[model samples]
Target: MSSIPVGKGIPVDHVVDNTAEHPGERAPLVLNMHEFNDVTTTVCRVAESRRVPMAWYVAFVFSLGLLGFLGFCIAYLFATGVGVWGLNNPVMWAFDITNFVFWVGIGHAGTLISAILFLFRQKWRTGINRFAEAMTIFAVICAGIFPGIHVGRVWVIYWVFPIPNQMEMWPQFRSPLLWDVFAVSTYFTVSLLFWYTGMVPDLATLRDRARGKIRQIGYGLFALGWRGSNRHWHRYERAYLLLAALSTPLVLSVHSVVSFDFAVSQLPGWHTTIFPPYFVAGAIFSGFAMVVTLAVPARELFGLKDLITLRHLDNMNKIILVTGSMVGYAYSIEFFIAWYSGAMYEKFAFLNRAFGQYWWAYFIMVSCNVITPQLFWFKRIRTSIWGMFILSLIVNIGMWFERFVIIVSSLANDFLPTSWDVFIPTWVDIGTMIGSFGLFMTLFLLFCRYLPMIAMAEVKAVMPEADPHHDDHASDAKDEEGGANS
Candidate 1:
C-alpha cells in the first residue's frame, strides 16, 4: 500500500511486516470532504423532511393576527387622534413612552451579546451571535417605530432630524427628545451596518451552497461578491473590530440618553440619578432573555445542537443570572436611596411603585426578573430546555412589567393628589403593545426559517481542528512514541 507524507514529505509504504503490529495510533478522525458531504446531505434531508411544528404555525398565525390588530390601532389613532390612548394632562408620557422604553430595552441584548461578548473573545458566542445581531437590528426597527408614530404627527417625524428642511427648524439640542433622536438613530444605523456586515460572509456561504437560481441570485446580491479571500477577511475583521469598539460605548450611552428623558424631568420617580444605570441594566437583562427565547427554538429547529451545545445555553443562563442580579441590586438600591435620602417625593414614588394602584405590575416585575432567574443556580435547571425556556418567557414578562411599573406607577400618583388619576390603557394601547410582539416573532420566525441559523465558518474556526497546536509537534511526538513503543 502506498503511504502519504504528513509533515516533512517523507513517504513510507507497508512499514510493518505484520499488519497488527503497526496498529495506527488513532487520532480523532478529522472530517474530510466525504464526511462533510455526508453531513451536509443528512442535514439537508432532515431539514427538508421535518415538518415545522404546529406550535410555530399557531404562533405565526397569532402573531400575524396581532400585527393586524396593531394596524387597526394605528388606523384608529390616525383617524381619531392620539387621544384614543390614555395620555392626558400631567401624564403626557404613558403607554407610548412605556412601549418605546420596553422595545428599546428588548433591543439591547442583541448588541450586548454580539458586540460585547465578541470584544471579550467568548468563543461560544459563535453559536448564537448572528441571530442575536439580527435580533438587535429588528428590535431597534420595532423600537424606532413606536417613538416615531407616538409623536401624533407621524408625517412630520422628519422634523426630529437635523437635515436642511423647508421649515429650517433645527431640533432643540437641549431637549432629551433630541438626544434620543440622535442616540436611537445612531444606534440603529450602527447596528444595521454591523449586522449586515457580519451577515455578508454567511450570506456568501449560503449563496455558494444554494440549490436554485433564486437563492443564488438573492443571497449573492446580499453577499456583495464576497470570496472569503485573505485580503477580504483582513479588512472585514478590522471593520468588525472597529464597529464593535464604536458600538460598545453606544450600548451604554444610548440607554443613558433614553433614561435622561425621565431623569432630567423634575417628576418624582422620573428624577432619580439611578435611572441611567438602571435603564441600561434592565435593557441588557431583557435583551439577553429575548436572545435565549429565540435561540432555544432556533437551535432545535435548525438541528444546531452540536453547534449551540448545552455549554452555550449554560453560559447564557449564567449571563441571565448575573444581569438579573444586577437588576435586582439596582431595584434594591433605588428603594434604599429613596428612603435614606429623606426626600418625600422619592419616598412616595417608591412606595407608590410597590403598593399603589399598579402594585400587581411591580410584583410581577420582581417575581419575573428577580425571583425567576434565581433558579439558574442549579446546573440541571440552567441546562434543561424546558427550564431555560420557561425562565426566558418569565424574563420577558418581568421586563415588560418593569417598564409598565416604571411608567404607570410614577404617572398614576404624582405630588398633587388632585392631578393623580389611574391611567388605564385603552384598547389601542393594548393592541399596539401586543402587535409589537407579533412583529418581533414574525420577523424572528422568518429569520430562523430562511437564514443559516448557525455561523458555520465561525463555529468551524473555534473547533479543535482550527487550533494550530491540535495536530502539531506534541501530537506527532505522542503518536510516534506510541507507534514505536507498540
Candidate 2:
C-alpha cells in the first residue's frame, strides 16, 4: 500500500486497514499504517525531549495553590482539634467519613480498567489505564487524609496499628475502621507497585531518548537497567501478569471491605447484606466519572485527543450508565427490604433521608447519580467533549452527595428520637473537603509533568503493527486455501 498523507483534509474512509488480525475493530485514533510510527513517537515526545507547554504550567501553578490551602487546613485542623469541625453526638462520622468513602470510591475505576480489563484482554484500556492508575494512587492519598485527621489528636494516630505498647493495648482486629486501614493501605501499595512496574519499560524508552545526562540519569534510576532484551521482557511480562492477577481480587475486596464499614454497623440504614455489591458498583461508577473528568481536561491541554479519543469517552460513559443503573437498583432493593422486613427504623431512616432536614442531599444524590448519567445514552452527548466533561463532573457531584446522604442522613436520625440531631458542616469541614481536591490535583499534576501520561509500551502493543501476522495476511489466506485443497 502506498503511503497516503493524513492531514486535516484526510477522510475517515481513507484510513489504512492495518488491523487485519483484528478485523472490524474500531481504531481509537484512526491513524493509517503510514502514520502509525510517527504518531506513536509523537505520543511519547512529551516524556522524551518536549519542553513544558504553557497550559501545563498554568494548571500546575493553580494546583499548587490548592495544595497550599490543603496544607493550611490540615495544620489548622491539628492545632484546633476535631471540635473545630461540625461533629456532634449523632453525626460524629459525618463529612470526614463521607469524603473518605467518596475518594476511595473514585479510585475504584482505575483498578477496574487497568487490572480487571487487562485480565479480560480488553485492548481499549491500554490508552488510559496508566494515568487512571496514577489517579487512583492520588485518590487513595486524598482518602487517607480525612480519616487520619478525623482520628483527632493526629499525633497518637499510630495506636490503630498492630504495634505493641507499654500499656499492652493491642489494636482491635474486628473493627471495620481497622478493616479500612488494612484494605485502603494494601490497595494503595499494590496499585503503586503495579503502576511503577508497568512504567519501567516506558521509562527505559524515555531514558534512551533523553537529551541530557541529568535527564538520562533521572529516568535511568527508575528504568532498572532495562535493556529490552528478550530475557528482560520475559521477566517483566510475568511480573506484570502476576501483579494484574493479584490486583483484580484486591480491587473487589478493597471496596467490599469499605462496604463493611456500613454493613457491619447495626445502625438501621447501615446494616444491609446488599451493601458490598452496592458500594462496589457505586465505586466503579464514580471512579469512571472522575477518570473522565480528569482525562477530558488533560487530553485537551496536552494535545492528547488522538490517544484518549471520543470512542474512549463514549465507552466510559456507557460504564457510567450501567453502574449508575446498578446503583438505582440497589436503592430500590433497600427501600423494598425496609418495607418488607417490617423494620420501622429502617423504613423511617430511608424516608427521613429523602424527606427530612437533608432532603436536598438525597435529591442531589438521586438526580446526579441515577438521572444525569442517562443522558449518555444519546450518542451525540456521549461523544461531545464538553458534554462528557460536564456530565462526568455532574456524576462526581452526585457520587459525593451519595456518600454524604449515606453517612450524614443515617446518623442525623438514629434509633431514639431524642438522640436524633441534624448534622451541619462547619468551615473546617468544608475547607478540609475542598483541600482534598487540591492534594489530589497536586499529585496528578506532578505525575503528568514527570511521567508518561499514557502507557507507551502497552499502547504500542495493541497497535496493528504489533501482530506477528500483520503483514502476512494475504499469504496466510493463500496457505490456508492450499492446506484445505490437500
TM-score of each: 0.87, 0.92
State which candidate has the highest lDDT: 2
lDDT of 1 by residue, 211-325 (tens): 8898889989998999989998899899999998999999999999999998998888888899999899889888888888887877676566655566677778888999899
RMSD of each: 7.6, 4.8
Cα-based lDDT for every prediction: 0.77, 0.82
The local distance difference test score of model 1 is 0.77
lDDT of 1 at 108: 87
What lDDT tens digits, residue by residue, belong to model 2 across residues 1-486?
A: 336333222233454431222333344333432345554465666666468788778877887887888888889888888898888998899889999999999999999989998888777788799999999999999998888988877887898888888779988988998988999999999999999999988888788878899989999999999887988889888988899999999999998999899989999889999999999999999999999999998888777866776667777888999999999999889989998989899999888988998999999999998898899888878887889899999999999999999888898898999988887788888888888898898899888877888887787666544544545552333222110000
- Tell me the RMSD of model 1 versus the true structure: 7.6
TM-score of 1: 0.87
